[model samples]
Target: MSQLRVLRVVERAHGILSSRDADAPDVAQVNEAHRSLRPEEVSKAVSACDRRDFLSMSACSLATALLAACNSRGPDEAEKVLRFAERQNEVVERWLLRHTAMNHARGRIAGSAFPMYFISKTLPVWDTATRGPWMLDVSGLVDRPMRFTLEDLVRLPARRQRVDHFCVEGWNAVAEWWGVRVSELARVVGVRAEAKYVDFRSFDSNFHESWDLESATHPQTIVAYAKDGKFLPPPYGAPARLHSPIKLGYKNTKYLTNVVFMAKRNGGYWSDQGYEWYGGT
Candidate 1:
């Protein structure tokens, strides 16, 4: 079935489901139309709903039915359905980030035991002896590509935020962070009009993550240099690291080395391996 036709059927289903006087006859007709669509057709219809901003509560009711119909198919089709659902989730998350303010309450600090993680076997640290002094290189799609030393970042206006950090593994911690806001750096470097995404690279086995420009420049997003009133410890991304309550823990790259403003997203360490690209908390 054509995507447009599928959408019409889904919309009809939504209307029937929403009606106070929905009758057996009306529901049966909607069911008949819905059952006639193949899994791919239903997927396309859901994508269409997402594009049209029809994934509201009404559309979700219809989608639940449509997905239920497709669930009988084999595992490959089930995987496709999963991907479609994840995409819809990303759409909702991006919309929320754009429309709402993240909770920045000064919660109790997690302190030394805040779960430490890195791709490397040992904690990734700046090898001052081998790699020389640590420097943050900001380049790509900006008028003034510049590198900043730790001292330079400390000299810039700093913001302190106490926020919760959520991990994909279902653990979370609250910490106090002090750093220069990413938006301030953008202003100083003159980010180009064409740069739609920001890529943060790390020395942690070349781990990196890309973010939409909006999230990258959020007032809460920062290259953190200190935590809980002391200079950042090596295990907690000393020298500098990206930190934001707006994104999941993995999205905030640690052991930072480079920041690239890009015209397109280049997937990050975990995101490239099937973690959601948006990675919103």
Candidate 2:
């Protein structure tokens, strides 16, 4: 079933290629690159069980398209980009509405039944037995810094949304995520008017991500506790994670420990490595 999902994504990519302007250099290059891969090789490439593997496999598949996209420059480029984004958003919204089941995690990453990958060198292991006492601290540039335990989070007003999760490496999956909106948290913490960014600090390797204050407070941005009706699996950032529908997968930091509202940016782990600082979808 998982493999089938990956295959479907490949098929969808092929469809996207067909719909693209054939005369466009980027489209032609992308088409050629995809065509160069044998079926077996394509299958192997999509069999990503973890972060490093996912990036490696998906990069090979998306490079030509990325290059072609980067090469194009024009006066109407900004308008074209906006329209392109709108179309993509509409497709994702429609897909999410059609498939809202809070079960099953499937994706382009083939081998893994659960497609989440830990990109970090070492994984953080929390004592499951001490779950209730775990805390999520919300502080910085707020009138009231607050610390909430898992019990507290569960008790807060929770919302669930089935949204498409896009990886920067160019693969996507849909999952039903349940948690409190970041705005709700911001309210509780009394976010200051001057705050410009919300920095998310994670327990795993002290990993961190920052987002524009508006994006962080967007209704679709949540401090997620569960995916698919269950407590988030460790690989998927169990206990809690920052989930934003508008952002790429890397922006959704796992093992989330603290959210610090600030005036300036605190560059994210991946952003430090040349990934876009604003990883919007």
Candidate 3:
């Protein structure tokens, strides 16, 4: 999507997202960009929506669109962006339904009504040695592969940003994020010309996702270490989670365990649920 379109959706909705501001009241420019955009570009944005419309979206829905866009340019993983919406098509018949937008620690424009998943782990934290794998791997079509534990990540040079959180549902919040520069990791991995996609898998469940290498190494991209002031909560994919600019919430798998480099596009967990595999929102 055009930067103007991306900005207008967030600006007009007052949605939360993480990125540098270009200008104010982007609606006119955004509309012009939308008109000038080639058919393919327009389709790209339209395809991202499952059941999108001016009213089909609540304040929360708009928040999700903007914040998600602000975090990073739509995933460079592929030319396609897809998402699965579990909406039940219950016409809201009312305009003043009180839709509000906010930001998250990752600075995404999002709708808070959807909420996030929080899984509990009651492991033996009491023991100092049984801290699981302790290391996350970033390896693919590169000469250098990385295997860093939580400690290793914290020790590395870090970057921080304040941005809004966007959700597929509706609602948003802004927060600060601190993590390793994604570009640094890309250099460490030695991204090759053959490399095209970077897949992410979480440690929590089998939640997995893929992104184009371009978006992976974008300046806004990061392998975060902390949110706000405290360590990442388990529910928020503690230890490590990708702050991807090119994907939707579902694509941003939490508790990243592995980063696989690939040459073709791959579908995500929710893709089979009637959502597009390239869900960029």
The 10-residue segment of model 1 with minimum total lDDT is 16-25
- Give a tens-digit lDDT track for model 2, residues 102-181: 22335432223546766668666566586545689999999999999888999999988777777888977777889999
Per-residue CA lDDT of candidate 1, range 1-281, in tens? Answer: 66677777877777844555545336788889978887767766766444335547678988787777664554455677778999999888877775248666555788987987789988887888999999999999988999999999999999998988988899789999999999999999999999999999999997999999999998889999999899988888887899998899999999989999999999999998889899996
lDDT of 1: 0.86
How much lDDT does candidate 3 score?
0.61
TM-score, cand. 2 vs. native: 0.59
Can you give the TM-score per candidate against the true fold?
0.72, 0.59, 0.55
Q: Rate the local accuracy (lDDT) of all candidates.
A: 0.86, 0.76, 0.61
- lDDT (C-alpha) at residue 256 in model 1: 89
CA deviation > 4 Å runs, candidate 1: 1-74
Clashes in model 1: which pairs?
none
Using TM-score as the measure, which candidate wins? 1
Per-candidate RMSD vs. true structure?
Answer: 17.1, 23.7, 26.3
**Best-first order by lDDT:** 1, 2, 3
| After superposition, candidate 3 runs with Cα above 4 Å error | 1-115, 118-131
